[model samples]
Target chain A: MEPTNERHLLEALASGDRRAAERLVDETYRQVFASLVRLTGGDTEAAADLTQETYRKAWKSLPSFRRRSQLTTWLYRIAYNTFLNSIRRPVLLQPIDEQQAVAIEDPDPDQAAKLQQRDVAERLRRAVIGLPEPLRFTISARFWGELAVEEIARQEQVTGAAIRKRLKLATSRLREALGEDAI
Target chain B: MTQPTDREVKSLLTEVEIPEPPADLAARIKSEIPADLSSGRFEGTDLEVFDAPRRSPSRGWLIAASLVVAVGGGLIALRQMDQFQTPAGALESGVVASEAAASDAVAPESVQYRSPVDQSLDDAELETVLVEEIQLNEPLETRSSMEAKPDDSRLQEKSTPGPDVTSADKVVVDEVTAGQAELDEVSADRDRSDRTRVDQKTVASQDLPSPATRKVERSEPAPSRGPQPKLETPSEQPQPEAPGEQQTRARQRADSTGAFEKRQAAQPPQAPATVESTAVAAPAPVRESARLEDGAADRSFAGARAGSALAGSALADSALAGSVLAGSYQQVRSALSEGRWPAPEAIRRAEIVLGFGFGGPEAESKQESASPADRFTILVDELVEILERRQATESELEHLLRRSRALATELDGQPAVEELVVWIEQIGALVESAEER
Candidate 1:
């Protein structure tokens, strides 16, 4: 959303305008849901719950929104944190390991290539999840959440240089973990 | 197999598949949301209009029940009165009996006649009949007092008995007049006391310092403890110091300790006994002021000690302005985690302080002192450097931890500080786990 329009909507939401909240949900829920889907490794149900949880949190925190970062970036940060907190719970459903499943017979080369891509994506997801503390968050937010380096830095309350450095370190770690050819 | 380049890896990350959200997801979420988003009430904001409490049917039923009981009691009493009034001769006899009972407690039981009609009456009816008889036989003075209004004109009329009035009526009038006089005296005394209290309050208010004067006093720097300067009389001293003069004096006092030490070391030391004797010889007001300054210093020292202790705990130090920024960060994180908004004031304070660093070179130049953002950045960088090296000594880690804790304490346990603390611990844990491996 445009910053001005977002600000106006935020003002309306802060004043308890229901229409503004509905409009916010309409504009952002898809992107938010998609980010959660990637973070949860294709668990659509958990992603949907987390998406709703993010909006609920966003609505509650609307009054304190300072327009420091773009509203979407702010929402993404909330979505990211929600994902982190959910993972901390003991009963969280583990992502299904598709690699170990019985292979289906494929006659076409395109079909086999698609399967290879899915495998690569799954491996990358696992490697990202395995990355420590802030690197995991940083890489996930940048790649999955699709947030800009500046936006992540603003959300993290750090310098742009620090965020870029983190991204570099996270990428190098991913490279090392996946074995360079895995990608 | 060929290794993927950084560009290819980045492209692959971007291409990771995301499932489409369910069609009913948005509708489901919105349905649960209240129509009025303003229901998420904020503290110190005049946005919410709360509805008045509704009256309950239970309270209404209680009132109705009370009315029914009272009306029923009244009807029963009235019925008893009607039975008593059936015969005038019987009523007269009852009043005489009641007067005898009241005036002569030792009246003979044989003299109290219980007729067949009276025997038919229950205990409640008999009691009601006796009460009515006593009210009829009461002295005129008692009845007059009970019926009289507080109006002065009515009391005067009652006091002036008519020519046909008996001696008993005259006695009643005199008693009523005496009672009215006592009430008037008490009301006058109350008025006097009220006026005296108000006057005392006015004087006390006048004696209190003005707001501006109190502000000045609060802003004033602590006095020095070196050799006492010669005291100045009210006439000799300037009436009121200018803002510049106040600032200069404060600055001088702040720098005085270093200057005093330098002077002491350069020159021969004076006898402590002589200095004490000179200080004691000072004027009473000057000595008192010095004593107050000493007390102020002691109190400030004690407060600092208390503040440090408080900062060491989980609770944030609200007195530190830097902590407000930290609080704002927490407010955002907590809002996400706990599903509540941050206070507007916390966000505003964070914005203002952050604007100093993030507002570009112009803002940095405008601010003469180091902004909280700068301090926060510096602390984060230092902590990160130590964590990255993973070769820090125990003492080094402790010192960094203390600095991190102090900053967090200033920010009031901002999640960033908590995150830093977590990172430090995680590094330690990783080292332990590696050793085990």
Candidate 2:
């Protein structure tokens, strides 16, 4: 994703270079897949298929891409749209209950002490799945995709300030749902 | 109300584990790249697998064009049929007049009379020789002439004008009348055959006398070889119908047959043998009168030939009229050559060739002023000139031949012009037979 390499790849892709398309796919497919898996609530198979589709769409739309943002950002935009389109039903978040919030906040000392009560990672996964779309997407791309805030803003077609405010709101909601003890 | 620090949230979000993507995912996507690019770099699922082949737009257009052509052709044929209808009687008369005109054109000169041959020999020998010659050279004519007596008996029943005959006789008469009507229906077709038979009879009669006289005259002793006597010896008598007696009977028989033939000419042109056989028995006078009728038949036939030739020329001259279709000419030629010429078919063909079809634009422009015979003469003269010029195409010549064929058909059953019909047919046969060569 260096400025020089991206510019060269973008130009080569615009000129219909297959190698550049392959190179772009290779550089971005993993991050896109990982982000989609989390975005799709642990649906790894669907996430993998959507990841391939995203690359294909990117290859076709590459010629029209102006390169105003990073290639990865453009790719993530395609991946997000691709996953959203492929899913048959709405991927809405369920409402959090007060007792579930209390379990994350002050885990019952007995429950916490139980030998094989669900681990912190499992609870965190459940908490992330319950987040709404776009907030879910933003949080996943930032943490799982490891994309910069500014990069996420560019990929999502939003201002950097709006992304930051969304990130703040998403974090507060997750905290309320999971409780301080879980963090 | 303060939000958690970005570092704290980022740290917590990092704890959220995401499952690893399949290792072969990118490899699978790459494998599909060539197929996608091959189909113009299409993205997403292949929809063509689900779709059936669509009908070509051009196929629909071709079907529409064929329908249009079929409908258009049907309309044109219907329109043509409407324009072509005509009453049959006027057409028949016009055709008859044209054929008679043609016969007159063929034999313009009247037959010349010659002095009677010498009468020195045996009557039995002369009759035997003439009969034998007729049987050999003019079998059909001889047959017809021989059959004429029975036919006459049959005709008597039909034309008897009395109810005294039995009911069965009346039925036979009715049948004969019906048959005659049928034959009349194709009068034009019979003319060529009748013409040929008449010509053969004329030749047989004239030539038969020659051999008989030659044999007898050669045997006689010379009387100083000076101018021979017109009279034969008294003991070497011919028939008891000596000069006036036999001549009158022969004349009367020939006259009846000849007049009967002339009347029948408007009917169908029956076989000439019927007429020829009746003349088989008569003495020199009967033979002489047969020769006179033959001469008359020849002149009529010659005129018909001239008419046919004229028709050919007229057709060539009016080739640009487009009024004469090849189909009509083919029908006329078929009728002429097919052994029977229906008067209706002959008239139809004649009008088409002569540009006289009802309401035809060409006929309107080229009014038919000359008599059919004179017009036929003009046509023959024109065709002769064209043939001499060597400027006409085979199609032009064929058109001429077809015109002659149509005229020949028109001339059928016309006993007066039987000779001309024969002549025109000879020309047609000559021209057509040349193709084999």
Number of the top-ranking candidate, with DockQ as the measure: 1
User: Over the stretch B20-43, how does candidate 1's per-residue lDDT look in tens digits?
Assistant: 889999987676455556665333
Question: In model 1 chain B, which range of ten residues has the least summed lDDT?
Answer: B354-363
Residue B341's lDDT in candidate 2: 37
Which candidate's lDDT is highest? 1
For each candidate, report its DockQ versus the true two-chain complex: 0.20, 0.15
Q: For model 2, how does the per-residue alpha-carbon lDDT over A1-183 read when each residue is reduced to its tens digit?
A: 788998897777666666776787787778888777765656777788778777767656665776677887777778876766765334432334788866675545566534232344445556665688878778767776678998888777899899888888887777665565444
Worst 10 residues of 2 chain B by lDDT: B355-364
Kindly provide the TM-score of model 1 when superposed on the true structure, using C-alpha atoms: 0.34
Worst 10 residues of 1 chain A by lDDT: A96-105
Candidate number with greatest TM-score: 1
Query: Positional deviation of A115 in candidate 2, in angstroms?
Result: 12
Kindly list the per-residue Cα lDDT of model 2 for residues B191-250, writing each as its tens digit: 334455444434533422332332243233320111122222212332211212112222
Once fitted onto the true fold, the runs of candidate 1 whose alpha carbons sit more than 4 angstroms away are A90-92, A95-110, A180-183, B1-3, B35-437
